[model samples]
Target: MPRRLFIPIIFLTMLSACGGTPASSPSEVASPASTESQLEALATTSLLADIAQHVAGERVHIESILPVGADPHSYQYTPQDVAKVADAKLLILFDDTSYETFLEPLLLTAGGDTEFVFAGAGVGKRADLDLGGFDPHLWLDPNNIIRCVENIREGLTHLDPTGAAVFKSNADAYVAELQSLDAWIVEQVNQIPAERRLLVTNHESLGYFAERYGFTIVGSVLESFSSGASPSAQQMAALIDQIKSSGAPAIFLDAGDNPALAQQIADEMGIRVVADLHLESLTDGAPAGTYIDLMKYNVTQIVTALK
Candidate 1:
């Protein structure tokens, strides 16, 4: 019942319904090349794809399964995505069980000698968090991303040992940028008074961010990492009370998810909704278009609202 397997089943059904023949026989179907002559990396999400692009540089071609603004928590796979997986030389997944529920079957079926690397695997999994599971949003912390970048560099080097030097150089430069970003965030966040450094988000997606930037999460309307779940009336009431008690300036929400509930909570609490946090996805060619920009945007918003 893996969602990824459903794509091939649907494709075969469509072919049968049309009485159409495949151009190539099953045995003759193109498989991923075992030799790393050409490097193709399939990343599970755009955020990871961006980081991989930084590490791979010109040595590899990178493609992402999730589109910009797509929710990784509820992304669905398609036939085209299956072909992308089948054609890649390396497959990089978040692997904190983030994509396992959906991408596991496609990965298993099409991985054929493909170098599969779990980018977050080396960061070690955390299972005791209170978001119904561990929080998989490790990329929110630049320090953690530094670790992820190292994992990516190792994965790329393993696939193309000849270009190992280039991968290392790229990773070093990107890691430096991440370090700078972390320092910059600390400086900017310091502008907010300690009492105002409270974050009340739509979901518990800002745990890593709060932990990194010295902000405390007062509460979330939905007490989970994903926005797919809705808050009950009791939960909503509790969040409103927390916001009022903690004096959180605004309720932050990601772009794609509906902000009605958040807006309602803000209205009842006499606070504002901070629509500037792009927690789950990047913006399309905006100031917050890239992962770096996304962090800058969120920090700016938090400073503006909380300070």
Candidate 2:
């Protein structure tokens, strides 16, 4: 079996060793295990999966459909993925249609038996809300993440009532951590000269991050949030002009997405391209393995590059 399948198998074995019921297959385990009474959660991406893990603690089993290094913007569903979704007792996805175009069809085909939660739903409003649609990357802002964390806690509590206390405790602790991170980010960003607090990125994914951190979004190489959309000549020209005028030091790129366009833009405008911000997905084994680490790494890189 592939490593992905093998890891879950090992995980299941460990669960079994603890007297939890063993799942016959990943798909067969979505329902609550009568023996263990644990809810099975299927998160759309690794970012949400990490958050769900913290919220669920030992009460639920959480799995992510898109593996490490996979671009959520263009991910396609496989049969195995469909099975996993069908098996899940609860599902969590980042709203705003970032990478979930495949989800509706999968859910329709699989039926609506599974409870679904949109983590970004009902979160704080976006500052540069030019997204045309929702920006789905709500977790970019620590305050917004507090909402997402609350939603995850609610969903888990609803699914597994017995785990309500644990979920609440975990959510409270995580929210405190997020609050500390927000304060630290504000402090760190204060070091950057006000004029240098300009962010230009491969896409408009940083609007919330910039809004939260007081950074000005100079412009994006791609005019839209989704990487599927490309910029027209006029947009590109405008971005180049913004780069020149704002004196932004660097452009950030998603590690899994192609950076060629960002590179071209940087080359044309003579700006630096900061590497591997890990915007969409967490790296397999790095400083950005968790959502908190990803945010910390990004903020550190942004502050360093700008300073």
Candidate 3:
């Protein structure tokens, strides 16, 4: 081989040694090992599912029984959902009977060895609402979510002792995030004057939210805790009178509920009606995608509407 041929061969060898491959972008990079191989958990709602995912991290696969915008208070469980629950190794549910009215019977009849972890564990009743029981919207308050995270962490650790450290670390980090979110929410709420911190929601969904924050529950359209119930003519008339006297700026409706009732009330009082606030379930691609995002989105909507 001549000198020119030898030099070309050397260059080809160097190119081959380097593989001549383009580097993978961040999106194209292989993800770390998924915890799908580990125990799978089923959460009753999307909000609870988000909390469980944050606590369990990649150590446990968390699935939500409710769809993106389904009303857990009125959602009927399908046979597929029952199968999902029965196949799960853990079940995370809110302990309120009114909210998750369908979960208890389904769990009992499903006949699975699924370990239970209640998000509303140790959480007491809501003194603000007359729903005949506890408020299941405890996740609205991030502090309550801290308790939920701890309960979920304990359950996950008990299920997989070897993953305790992972669960603890994730829970600690997530709790810190929740604390920061709580402080931010307080600051956001403070922007509105004390007199303007009045809220009128679709139902009793925001009892815990108003209690945690400084808002006053002026009235709800349904007067009941669950969205499945209907408001009587007398209740509607009374709520209209309350809104007219309270001078509340907006009627906040659940993202999943029909806003016709709220619209009717708002039309009567000439007040604004905000229907994008996610209360029970997280949105699929909406601004309120995660638990924290949902809170921030609601806060922004409230502050904007009231301030």
Candidate 4:
């Protein structure tokens, strides 16, 4: 095996032989598992991590694949990440095999029989808008996230059948919270005039939000769904024309995306770019430490900008 893959295989072999995850160098990928069979909690995105943390309660430590404040759309797993995922009991993906393409190697590393779950699988909507792929950002809508929570609850219960009651109870409670959020958003969005509720985001990151909350997606600064994809000159010109015609007040940029292009567009259009939306990841605390907070913060920003 290659050195990167070889190291993890050897490390796991040590875990089996010693009946524990052995001490290794600081550079080595530390398995969250204490024992070979213990579940090492892992989720594919920080936003997903926050959502799952509520359902998990105290059962397991749910670590995110991308660090706080990182953009998952452009994230690539390192060799260390492959090793960490090999020990996971359940891998939570934001989408099916289509989006989150960077995770393919990690899935292969985890082997064929390892359990996995797609939080947005049953979300019941996939558009061909994402550069010949389905847009998988179903969690943008709180209603859709209720479906995600259900899937997560099932996945966790599958791994730890003993905690079925706790998982179900927490999932029920969290889904209620999501419902409350959905209602709260309706009230808040009502403050904005129907015509003013237009979104021009950094990318095609707000389709579900637009669908759920009665906002129109004017256009995106980026032509493609993935933030990693760049816009062509023709695409940029089209987006500028759309924003001009729609009279969209702001270009909502995720905190992690490069702001120069958005800033340029805003300058040319004489509109401001709202760069505070925590669309991809949560922060350490405050503003957007949790999934609910992220939605509230983004909504508040949008309302302030457009209303």
lDDT of 1 by residue, 1-307 (tens): 1112111100111222332232334543455443434567788888888888999999898888888888888877777776676665577776544444567655554443355666775553334345666677878888888878887888888778989999999999999999999999999999999999999887788878888788899998788877777878888888878888888888888877678888888888789998757887777787667788888888898899989
Best by lDDT: 3
Residue pairs of candidate 3 with colliding backbone atoms: none
**TM-scores of all predicted structures:** 0.85, 0.86, 0.85, 0.85
Could you list the CA RMSD of all candidates, in the order they appear?
A: 6.7, 8.8, 18.4, 7.1
The better candidate by lDDT, 1 or 2, is 2
Please provide, for model 3 over 39-102, each residue's C-alpha lDDT reduced to its tens digit, 9 standing for 90 to 100: 6788888888998999888878899998888888888888888667665667788764456788
Span of ten consecutive residues with least summed lDDT in model 4: 1-10
Could you give me the TM-score of model 1 versus the true structure? Answer: 0.85
For each candidate, what is the lDDT? 0.75, 0.76, 0.78, 0.77
Identify the runs in model 2 with alpha carbons over 4 angstroms from their true place.
1-34, 96-99, 127-131
Candidate 4 residue lDDT tens string, 54-115: 99888867888778887776677886676666656567776654556677655565442346
TM-score of candidate 2 against the unseen true structure:
0.86
lDDT of 3: 0.78
> Which residue pairs does candidate 2 place in steric collision?
30-87
lDDT order of candidates, top first: 3, 4, 2, 1
Backbone clash total for model 4 is: 0
Candidate 2 local distance difference test against the native: 0.76
Lowest-sum lDDT 10-residue window in model 1: 4-13
